[model samples]
Target chain A: MNRTQLFEQIKKKSSYLCVGLDTDVDKIPTHLRSAADPVFEFNKQIIDATIDLCVAYKPNIAFYEALGPKGWESLQKTLEYIPKDVFTIADAKRGDIGNTSALYAKAFFEHMSFDSITVAPYMGEDSVKPFLKFKNKWVILLAHTSNPGADDFQLLQSTGSGKKLYEEVILKSQQWATPDKLMYVVGATQAEKIGGIRVLAPDHFFLVPGIGAQGGDLAQVSKFGMNKQCGLLVNSARNIIYASSDKDFATAAKSEATKVRNEMENLLNSLL
Target chain B: MNRTQLFEQIKKKSSYLCVGLDTDVDKIPTHLRSAADPVFEFNKQIIDATIDLCVAYKPNIAFYEALGPKGWESLQKTLEYIPKDVFTIADAKRGDIGNTSALYAKAFFEHMSFDSITVAPYMGEDSVKPFLKFKNKWVILLAHTSNPGADDFQLLQSTGSGKKLYEEVILKSQQWATPDKLMYVVGATQAEKIGGIRVLAPDHFFLVPGIGAQGGDLAQVSKFGMNKQCGLLVNSARNIIYASSDKDFATAAKSEATKVRNEMENLLNSLL
Candidate 1:
């Protein structure tokens, strides 16, 4: 989906929330274990419970991949189950050489039909450019991640540019793709930095994780990260999906999602 | 495989050759498309032909992932088919937040049983540390890549330490894992730089790709990059695997692998 279409979805739903499907099989409800594809079954219910309350669904690809080829099948099924109007993200942080990256773009964008795939920027331009080649697809490059290790190299000062490595990434990547096709994964845990990051790429969308289970303050992220088009996809995974480990897990998820959405609606109505 | 076992295999094979199974289904011989699992069939023949000549088999994950669930099956079958003596590399180049990285490590190391998996160091210590938790597994972090875009961020000088970005990666990563568990992906294309990178992590093995088809110099790499234990796995993918497009593809692949192995053996004999 293009930036306008995504923003439209957000406005229509009165939310910019992106529910993450970090669905680990071992953590799923015990009753669903007997299902043919428990992961997909779990995701189906989560999507059903929360689809009206969110604009996108981001599936952490690692959870599915850990199950082996069967995991990939579950992921494919989950992708097919999500409705077309809501955006889908293959939260597979993939990047490689140009040719190899092209095949990845083909896998996520063409074959499985995800609207976007999170890419690692360490391999630099050619590694990321292939994903930008697909029309209407987005490339959410990692910048200022919420993980503790984000400080390791991302915040290092570049002698040449005098910018932090993540800052350099944000500035340099603008030459590759515009806001229409490119976005940044600015972790919501770094709530204060979101404003600074916003100033760097004023028009670009930001796929913000680290809010729910990571204990990031949503108000801070919403205040600093939102833009004219509601340029934020604040993702909440564990706190919603695993709200309950019983038969009422989906209902619990919906309640948690509804609470987050109600607050997001107030913010969108007032802020955007 | 442990470091000693890997070196033993290198000594036994008299070559540090890593056959890259960057197997594009479209490029495989047309006759094999008729097989029940054509990609797996193609890989089986290639593995049968080159297993003796090469010490490690690095299957580029994108090739399999692009084909969807079936592609994953092909990869699993290929992994099971490779003998225990040969070191297997996922070449997935995956890294994420701590928990996520753990899942990826579980996927590749536990489920797939690869000896090593290439990881992107963009996220720093925690992102990579989880992979090190696995026994006898390796994390071959990207230090300097072969693609043209490698110049974009890797070579940038960091002001704080006065080291290039990749240099800092090599230096700082040592604090997280011993050389036995950690390796670097120092592209053979930049043969001269390999010497400098090797100095930073003297004991760590380097998985060198970009030879053959990518025009990396084998002689320069072997001369500058080799350690006492022949600490380099020089990969050649398209140059060897797609050597022939006819029914004699396996024979052609064997011939090419034999030529590269011969070169590597000479390097080991004279240099070591």
Candidate 2:
């Protein structure tokens, strides 16, 4: 999906929610275990429940990867099941050298047909540039992550640039891609810093994780992070998906997603 | 495999050579295309021919992932085909949040049964710590990479510690894992810097790539990077694997591996 189409989906839904499919086999409802492929079955119902409530689906690749070959089959099925209009983000934090990164681009973009894939910026511009070559695809580069370990290297100040490492990443990466092709993963936990990052890359969308399960405030994220285009796809996974492990799991997931979407709707109204 | 087991393999084989199984379907011999699983067939032959010449096999994950589920099956088969005593390195530069990283560790260590997996250290301590939890599995962290893009962030001086970002990675990561469990990727192209890195972590092995295809010098890597335990696994992929795309491909691969192993043998002798 292009930036304009993604914005259109957001406006149509009245929510910029990106439901994260971090579906673990052990965490799913036990009743589904008898099914041939429980992981895909669980994801299918979750998508059915929440499809209209969100504009994007971010499937954390690690969950599928841990399951091995069968897991990848589940992933392929899940990706094909998601409506083409809704943006699909392969939350695979993949980055490597130029040639290898090209293969990764082929894996997610060409082969699997995800609209975007999250990339780690540690390998720098050449690693990121490969993904940009594909038209209408997005590269959501990691900036200030939500994890406690984000403080490790991301926050360090670079002597040459005088900006913090992530700030430098944002600044340097702008030279490689425009807002239409590039986005940043600014954790909702770092809500205050979003305003500053907005100033740095004012037009680029921010894929905001850490909203619900990670203790990030949705109101703060909307207040500080939103651009005119509704440039925030606030993600909530466990709080919504695992809301109920009973037979009513899908219905419970819908209720949770509705609650969050309603809050997002109110936030959008307040903006006007 | 543990450190002692790995060193024993190096001594027993008289080489610290690591053959990179970066198997691309397009690059394999055309005759093999008729096989049901050409990539696996090519890899099996490569393993059969050169298993004794090298101590480690580093399979770059992106290549297989590009082919989807069947590719993963090939990877699994190739992993199972390798001799248990030889070390297996999943050159999958994967790292994420604590919970997610744990799943990655499980994917490579538990599901795939790799001895060690390469991890990008941009996410910090918590991201890396999960991979260390497995009993004898290893985390080979990226230090100074061989790519031209490595110059971007890794070489920059950090204002906080007055050290290069890669240097800080080396120092901080030491607190996470001992030499027994941790290794660093010090590219053979950065041969001059390997001496300094060796001083930083004298006992930890260095998985050095960029020997043949990338123009890294073998003599320099052996002289500066090798410790008393021959703590270096020099990797050469394209130069060895694609030595000939003909009927003699496997034999040609074996010959290239032999030539490199002979050079490594001479280096090992000089060290004694």
Candidate 3:
């Protein structure tokens, strides 16, 4: 969906919660393993249970890819299953050179039909621009990631610009595309920095992925991160999907998602 | 293969050349497009032709991934077809959180049985170390890439160390893994920087791309980048694989491989 449509979805749902599908087969309940495609089955149930509570679904590509060929099939099936109204982010942090990046764009954008795919900006402008070419597709650039590893390189100061590498990324990348076609993956763990990063890209959406399971508070994220457009996609995967391990897993997922969505609704009410 | 074994393969073949299997479906021979699996068929022929000449085969994952499940099947078949002695680099360029990174590591090293997988170092130490946990499998970290975008963040100076971001990456990443399992993706396009980068990590192998197709010179790279063990696997993808788009594509690929290998033999002779 385009930026306007995405914002509309946020307004309609009163929740910008993005349910992450980082579905690990081993982590799922033992009962589901008997299914033909355990991963897909788990994803299908999660989608069915939580669709109303979230506006986006991010399938962490590593989990699917680890399963080999069957994994790709499952992933394809999962993407097909996800309703088009909700935004889909292929949390496939893929980036390469010019020609190769185009191929990656084709993989996620054309073949799989994801609305956006997260891309690592360490490779620079040319690596990012190819994905931006698709009319409605979004390029969610890694800015300040939530992972402990974010401290490793994201904070380096550019020799010329004197901005932190990610700040440089945020500023430099804006020249490539407008806020409509681009977003930043700002980790929810670093809520203090969210205000600063939001100021840098005031209008662009931030796909925040650290609220649950990663110890990030939604209130702080909402307070600092909400734009006039309510531009924040707070993602929680394991916390909701694995809320229960048995046959009640999907129902439990709904309960957890409802709680989060209710919280999101109150936050949105304050902002609107 | 281990570093010593990889070096031995270089000695045995008299070549440190790495043939990149970036087999695009549209770019393959017309006759092969009619086959059961065109990409695998094309890769099979190319592998058969160039197997003896190159010491390593780096399959650029974007090409296969773009084709979806079928492409992955082709990659698996091609991986199975390649002889074990030659080092296999899954040019997947993947990196994420600790658990997620492990899955990607399993995807390539365990599922596909690749000797090494290239990873983007943007997310920091935790994102990269999981891939290092695999025994005898290498993590070819992206240090200096060949694309025009390498100038983006790679050249930025770190706040504390005053090292360029890529230099900081090369130096800081050393703490996570030893030279035994860690290598750098130092692009051959940056020949002038190779000597200085060589000074930082003298023992670690540098998987150099951008040689033939991207205007990188082998001799210049050899003059600056080579170590006592011939620690460089220069990659050539489109130039070798798409030498001819006809049924003679394999023959032309072999001819191109022969030419590159001959040059590499002379370079290795001087180094040894």
Candidate 4:
């Protein structure tokens, strides 16, 4: 919920890996199809198999949303399945008008019980601030993303700082909330720049996606990105979710998740 | 769900209003609380009552997501309740890794059947291009937001053209998708600047929020932003939803919606 609590969980679990529940219906094991809600069934299994090994479960909302009502039902159930000690992220990338964002904060935090939700900061403070109003919830603002088009706007220089637009977003947004509640979304693909990001907001967490399927080196990410509390949630979605796709799909997912968690454990151990 | 079909619905309804379903749990009618899922119940009622009055229903995903599993359920039901002829917008504002975005596209278009979804373009083309790949669906990119902090990044001038960051985004993103499938969110509060926006994106539909509660002037927005097919969806969310707190909330909402529709009709007439 808060930074220290999140840090303690990472230490307790001996891992900083956040299993991304980016569950695609077609991608789920065929065995799950007969379950009441296949997506949730799959997620429940994954959480059941891997909860002790990881400190977080980041469910990318799109996967569940794609199934229509059933998909949403699955998403809700999956959120419920995740343990309270593990940080949960909607990974919704939501930000909007102030009042609307306030409602969104309530949706993810109050309703779903996610400890955090990823936010797009393009709309500025008003769009992001409403989410921060929730006690202990984190707002992971988009800083330097890993995508190719990240060059288009985020890398552009701003008036206040010769630094890129994302840098400006990071520096400027810090005024709105404290590091304990405010985090940054630094693409794991941009692993080389994690040090620069840490310099910007030294205390906040970074929801680093683009790790496995997206080709982000975990070594570099952990090396340059981790803070004193191992402040990086390295999310691996596809590589783990589709690790086997056989009868042992959930077991295979656990193995894949374990591999990442093991590497993260190594990194955390090295940090001391 | 394509541009022509969307345009036809606008003409048939004689209104360019897109009622925003930024429904908050605390804001919902007490009667709906008795239902199994109050948010969905509220959305079902709103859709049933306002079906013919507006051409589109933009459910701000945050509100539904805030309720967690139920919030997503409400979003699904709201999408289902909307008439097929009326455009449905998943105002989720999602943008992320290409693989993740592909899933988001599937969730909104293939699963939920939304005609369009809002996205944040700060991550650049790769983050946005995946959404554009869906046929007949639109990506309503955030260009100039209405919030006060919008000045922080969107209004900043890029180096070469002296164009504002949003202006540069408008010009460059136009190359990714045709105006038919791409729309920019130009805030109604920036009505005076719409003329400038038109210079870059003359024909793309503008999902204009902030008209009612955000103090965006409709007249100025239409005068500067309108294109031949009345290429503007003026959203009025809170001013309509919370129009009345009493038992007559639906009736009151209809009256408020009707007033905006009448004004939109007048705007259309003037444009024609």
- TM accuracy, model 2: 0.99
Model 3, DockQ value?
0.85
Between candidates 3 and 4, the DockQ winner: 3
DockQ-sorted candidate list, best first: 1, 3, 2, 4
- Tell me how many residue pairs clash in candidate 4: 8
lDDT of 4 by residue, B147-226 (tens): 78788778777666777899988999988999989999888887989988987888889999889888999989999988
Q: Which residue pairs collide, candidate 4? A: A66-B107, A106-B66, A107-B65, A107-B66, A107-B67, A108-B66, A112-B68, B64-B71
Q: How accurately is candidate 1 docked according to DockQ?
A: 0.90
- The alpha-carbon deviation from the true structure for residue A259 of candidate 2, after best TM-score superposition, in angstroms, is 1.2
Tens-place lDDT per residue, model 1, A173-205, is 999999999999999887999999999999999
User: For each candidate, what is the lDDT?
Assistant: 0.93, 0.93, 0.92, 0.83
Predicted complexes: DockQ each:
0.90, 0.82, 0.85, 0.63
Report the lDDT of model 2 for residue A198: 94
Give me candidate 2's interface root-mean-square deviation: 0.8
The parts of candidate 3 lying over 4 Å away from their true place are: none
Cα lDDT of model 4 by residue, A1-272, tens digit:
78888888888888888888888778888878998777888888888888988888888876666666566677777887777888888888887877778887877787667888888888888889988888888888888877777788887776545677888899989999988888888988877789998988888888888898878999999889988878788888888878988889878888988888888788889765
TM-score against native, each model: 0.99, 0.99, 0.99, 0.90
Chain A: TM-score in each model: 0.99, 0.99, 0.98, 0.97
Model 1, B147-187: lDDT tens digits are 99998999889888899999999999999999899999998
